[model samples]
Target: MVKQMEERHSIWLRIFHWTNMIAITLLVLTGFYIHAPESFRLFSNMDTPRMLHFAMAYVLVFGVIGRVYYAIVAKDAKNVLFNPIPDIKNLPSMMKYYLFLSDSHPDYGKYNPGQKMMYTGWLVMAICMIITGFILYNPNLFMGLGGSLGGLIAVRVIHYIINWLFVLSVLAHVYLDVSEGIPVLLSMFTGKIPKGFHDSAHTHDKSIGA
Candidate 1:
């Protein structure tokens, strides 16, 4: 009898992943529209941009929270939220593997070392954005953060910067699916991966790195 494999990304992840794709794309479009193209105002003075930006911001914030919620409820949040903490010990080893030095460094199961690091960075950056956003949203309420406006501004800057990083990650993610010889796209949509690939991962084989 063949050892039956199970799906990793649940229905909720599929829903949120696609929903987030939509929200993030809209945010980018509305964000760029309002970003200093002075002659191309869609509302005579860019009033529409502000409304759209705020709306998308709300959606993104809520969507992120929902994703974290699902990750928690699904019991895989620990690995998804924060794994591979990227310590000094793993630093050299991870680099070696990336440089093709050694493929036996470690087996990261669902997310490899680099991906875990990215996820960690995303979580921290998202928290920073949320905090700074609150400050900017209601500076009056955050009494001690009067001088914290600079921090809020910093978060704004980082938020935009991370947007590209996020997009880049998405690109790399897609490219890996296509180039790495895997049906990652279909797995995402159908919540299924070839059992051989799944087995490779569970068995900690040399070809399981994703």
Candidate 2:
């Protein structure tokens, strides 16, 4: 059989995706080290991890801004953003397919409802992390904000929780992508996938009915 390909991700998006991945990974590692040098022991000294952590935080800030700009300009928000009414309605079918209770799910365009929800949640979480991190990074600079949030301790706690959320969500994201197939996982790197890769299940359903 001849294999055809279709663009699944744009070049700019791939850039942002990989860039943010690196930044987030480094940030998480450095964060663990900074949080407890004795336990993590991933770094030799506080100076290096602290510097890398702050640097990656800035990288993440720009990566997010670039990704959002690209999404808006490319009109790709519809592919990833959650729509409450229709997406909520889509939940049952998607869940059924994932749980192996169904062989096929309705075609959900570029992404399933679950993916849309996850992406949207990640966006919100990233924004929250940025805000809390900024406040924690410089309490004096954001003293009013920190005080309003019950001081630096509270802000630090919020930042830490969000970091863990990022970790767990990224794991789930990778699992879901790979579960679909190796092609799905590679699409982010290659920016293309075998045409109709996502629609195969729905197409099978149609063929069976016909």
Candidate 3:
């Protein structure tokens, strides 16, 4: 059977997604080496990794800005941004689907509640990392803010903890995406999905309602 292709992601969104992924992957690797020069042997010396880390930090910063701009102008924010009241109400159904207790979940716009939560989380985490990273990067520049945030030590701890969170979250994201089937994964690259793919979720919801 032929599967019609439908555009799920825009060209710019795909660009930003891949670029952000690359930037984050480099940041994590460099972060590990920087965190423990003795343990992570990915980098031979501090110079290269430190330089790369700083460069990728800037890359991610711009990526985030551009992605947010695109989301706003393209009217895509509604698809991913979590709306507290409605999202809270819809969370149970999404949880049931993931837990195998339910076969279908509500059609919560382009993204379901869980995806909205994760994507929203990554945004929050990214912002936190950026702020903490700068504080750590330039102690003197952010001296006042750093002191308010419990001094440089607190900022370092926040940066380190969030780095771990990013690693774990990315691992789960990769596994879940792969488990969903390659098409779902490929959609990130191709910006298209098999026709009727998204409809399947709502199909069951409607059937149950009827």
Candidate 4:
């Protein structure tokens, strides 16, 4: 049987997806070096990676803003935002599928409950990172606000913790995507997926109104 292709991601979404990925990868690398100048050796010296880190921080800021705008305009929020009630209801089946205890699961939306939760968490984490990052970047300017949050040391600690979370979450994300099948992974790059990929897994929840 000949399989048709379906558009899974828009050109703009794909572009932003990759741009954000690149920015995150660079930020993580440079972040590690900055966090531990003696241990991490991805860059020759602190100066270069520090510059790159600050530059990429701005890229991520705009990327987040643009992506949020696109999601709103494209009405894509339904596909990714975690709605506590329905998502909680669907979690058992999703967990079963992940645990190999179920062959099929309820179709939550474009993304499963797990994916929705993760994506939403990333949004929160990114915002946190940005806020803390800026304060750290200019301690004096943000000193008053930073002090309200528990001073510079507290902000630094939160930033470091979030950086680790980003690293670990990205690793899990890559593994889960590849495990689903290469086609699933490629869809983010090519913006298309084999026909019936979703159907083969389970019927999508049309009632969610994405």
Instruction: Please give each candidate's TM-score.
Output: 0.72, 0.94, 0.94, 0.94
Candidate 4 Cα misplacement greater than 4 A, ranges = 203-210
| Model 1: per-residue Cα lDDT over 45-150, one tens digit each | 5667667767766777887899888877787666664443554456677577656676445555576556667676766665665665566567678746635546
lDDT of 4 by residue, 9-29 (tens): 999898888888888899899
Q: Which has the higher lDDT value, candidate number 3 or candidate number 4?
A: 3
Q: Could you give candidate 2's per-residue lDDT for residues 58-171 as a string of tens digits?
A: 999999999899989999999999999999999999998888788878889888899999999988998998999999888889999889998888999999998899999999
| Residue 134 Cα positional deviation in candidate 2, in Å, after optimal superposition | 0.8
Pairs of colliding residues, candidate 3? none
Candidate 1 pairs with clashing backbones: none
lDDT of prediction 4: 0.87
The lDDT for every candidate, in the order shown, is 0.64, 0.88, 0.88, 0.87
| Segments of candidate 1 deviating more than 4 angstroms | 1-6, 38-45, 84-94, 102-106, 137-146, 149-155, 198-210
Q: Give residue 106's error in model 4 in angstroms.
A: 1.5
Model 1 TM-score, all chains together:
0.72
Q: How far is candidate 3 from the true structure (C-alpha RMSD, Å)?
A: 3.1
Residue-pair clashes per candidate: 0, 0, 0, 0
Q: Specify the poorest-scoring 10-residue window by lDDT in model 3.
A: 201-210
